[model samples]
Target: MEKAIFAMIASAVVGVFVYPKFIEFLESKGSKQEVNEFAPDAFKEKKKTVTFGGAVFVAVPIIVMVILNGFTLNRDLFLLIMVYGSYALIGFVDDYKIVTEGKNDGISAKTKMAAQLGLSVVFYAVYILTGGDNMLSIPFLKTPINLGIFYLPLVMFMLSGASNAVNLTDGMDGLAGGTSLIAFIPFAYYAYKVGNFGVLLFILAIIGGLIAFLFFNRKPARIFMGDVGSLALGAALAAVAIVLGKEVILVVVAGVFVFETLCVIIQKISWKLRKKRIFRFTPIHYSFTLNGWDEADVVNMFYGIGLVCMVIGFVLLSLS
Candidate 1:
């Protein structure tokens, strides 16, 4: 745990300096924000800020983890980072194509989903082959459920679902990153309790890097994590929880994300079926903004909810 703290601090200190340069590098590459056409007008000012800041933060944690481990990779550590890095590649391609081509979206939705599921298959193979458990832990169930063959589908859904939930939540500054940082706290405890220090180290490293990223990511953000950050972060969270066998708690800890994703689904369904809308906006958080809530207020409010969710998740994990 002390080592994890060191990794976190190291990642944060390094990220603080490297991030500014990274933003500068993005600027040099002409990687500026290209707001979606339907996005609110307030987002116009963000056009000058750089996107893909996720690359820097993610790199910090990975590099720190490697160095701390004396550059060795155990099976669990390898799979953990494999999940993180691979999804990041998908997001990197997405962000790069979108920025370079000057498009609102880089890959088609179908293409992105395919990429996610495809990588998920690879991860599932590695996980099961490495003797990972197939038992699913529920918060209240006295017995753990064995998914066995069906765990594959769980892998696919958790990976894609978690990543996109964060992506949807990324509509505001400090929203996704801040909430995600809080979300990882309980997982860190679970990893340690389960004697999976590698995963704990990974989580701590991320927590530390996120601390630095959030400084720049706050309201009037200096940079955005873009798909690269959000997708990778979400995928990593799902992967971590899966490996820790705390899948049920992960959903509760990151409930804000699930809640937001549900809002999107409900909104779409209501619109398509009834020729009407549900919330004033999708993702639900944006509805408050449209109703005259300040962006910072909405972000803070979500952060508070995320904290409460994290506490609930921790308690549930303890009981389970």
Candidate 2:
């Protein structure tokens, strides 16, 4: 508990102080955001502003974690940090490419997927070597069912799915970060209750970092998290869920992410099947935008929906 509090304080202080300066630095370096062609007109004027600020938020927690937890490499912590850092690096490259080239295009989809898959393979190998069980916990059932050798592919899917889910959810300022903070609250409690103090501290640190980032990430965000923050956050969440043996519940608790991803999938499938698009735009949030809703309104609505889903998840978890 003491470690958690200390980490929170440290992360918050560092994040708040460092973020503005980082934004300025990026601006000076010509590292600004390029508005996507598919993005709303409202966002166009804000183009060339700083982005990828989530790197700072993520970094603070990791530094705090290492400093306080010491240098010993626990399997879980090692995987969490490695996956988080790797995804962040991938995002950084993408963001840097976009900013430097003055185009929306970053890394190609095929290349990015190849990189993510490679990282997933490494993560699974580490898990197996660390004596991590391949059994997945059923939400309602207390027992875990082993998938044996199939777990490798499953882990890869989980990691990749989570990464995309979060990337999809990053359509609005503070939307993904705020909702993720809410989701992390439960995971933090679960870790604490399960006597996983290290994981608890990690979650708490992330919560702190997100809270600090929210100061600038709210509506009309000063800096966007972009893919850097989203992918890293998603990967971290996956690692935590895997370690806690609560991967199934994560889908319920993070229903907002799932819904966002589903909207994209549904839209794509509908377009492919009927040669007609379902929504004005994919990811559902842009649907709201196309319907004349403000970004803040859509974000707030998602946050409300996230709260309800989280409550249900908590109730079900308690009952189970």
Candidate 3:
């Protein structure tokens, strides 16, 4: 508990203190954001803000952990950091392309998906080799569902989908950060309950870093986390879930992310099959904005719902 508290405090301090300097560095380097053309028109005001600010917060906790636990590096901690850091690297590349190219276009979708899949394979293989379970725990149930051979594909899908879900949820200021912060509370608790201090500390550190990022990323934001932050956060959440054997509960704790991804997927399938659109915007949060809710309101609503889901997930996990 002491270590966890220290990790959180150190990470939060790093995020809060380092972010200002990072933003100045980004601006000096001309690493500013370009609004996505497909984004809702209301977001035009955010153009040219410094981006990839998430990269700082993401690396801080990892560096802290490495310094603290270097001699005792465990498989779970190593895997968690490696998988998340690798995904952040991918997102960094995407952000670099967006900033330098002066457009939203990054790597091709196919290439990005391929990279995610390959990374997922490596993560799962390492997890299995390190004696992680092939069974999944279902919420509100006692028996573990064994996936046997199918666990590989399921793990890959969960990792990949988890990362993309946050990417889709990053459409609005404080949307992804707030939602993810709420989701991590219960996940960190779950890790603590399961005796996985490594995972617990890592998650608590992330929560702290996210809180600091939200300080700058709130309404009328001064900087953006870009794809780099979102993807890394999503991957970290997935890692926590996997380590705790509670991946299924993520669908509940991260309800907002699931909803946003579902909105996009449903919109895509409907448009391709029936030649029509579903919502005013695919993420559904922007749909709220389109329906007269302020961006702050949308972010608050997501935080509220996410807290409810997080609590429910905690209760269910406790019961099981």
What is the TM-score of each predicted model, taking all chains together? 0.97, 0.96, 0.96
C-alpha lDDT score of every prediction, in listed order: 0.88, 0.83, 0.84
Name model 1 segments beyond 4 Å from true: 35-38
Which candidate comes out best when scored by lDDT?
A: 1
Candidate 1 weakest ten by summed lDDT? 35-44
The candidate with the higher lDDT, 2 or 3, is 3
Worst 10 residues of 2 by lDDT: 34-43
Q: Give the C-alpha miss distance for residue 57 in model 2, angstroms.
A: 1.2
Local accuracy of candidate 3 as per-residue lDDT tens digits, 166-186: 888887778888888898898
Q: How would you encode candidate 1's per-residue C-alpha lDDT over 205-286 as one tens digit per residue?
A: 9998999999898978889898899999999999998888888777899999999999889989999999899888777887
TM-score for candidate 2: 0.96
Q: Give the lDDT of residue 300 in candidate 2.
A: 94
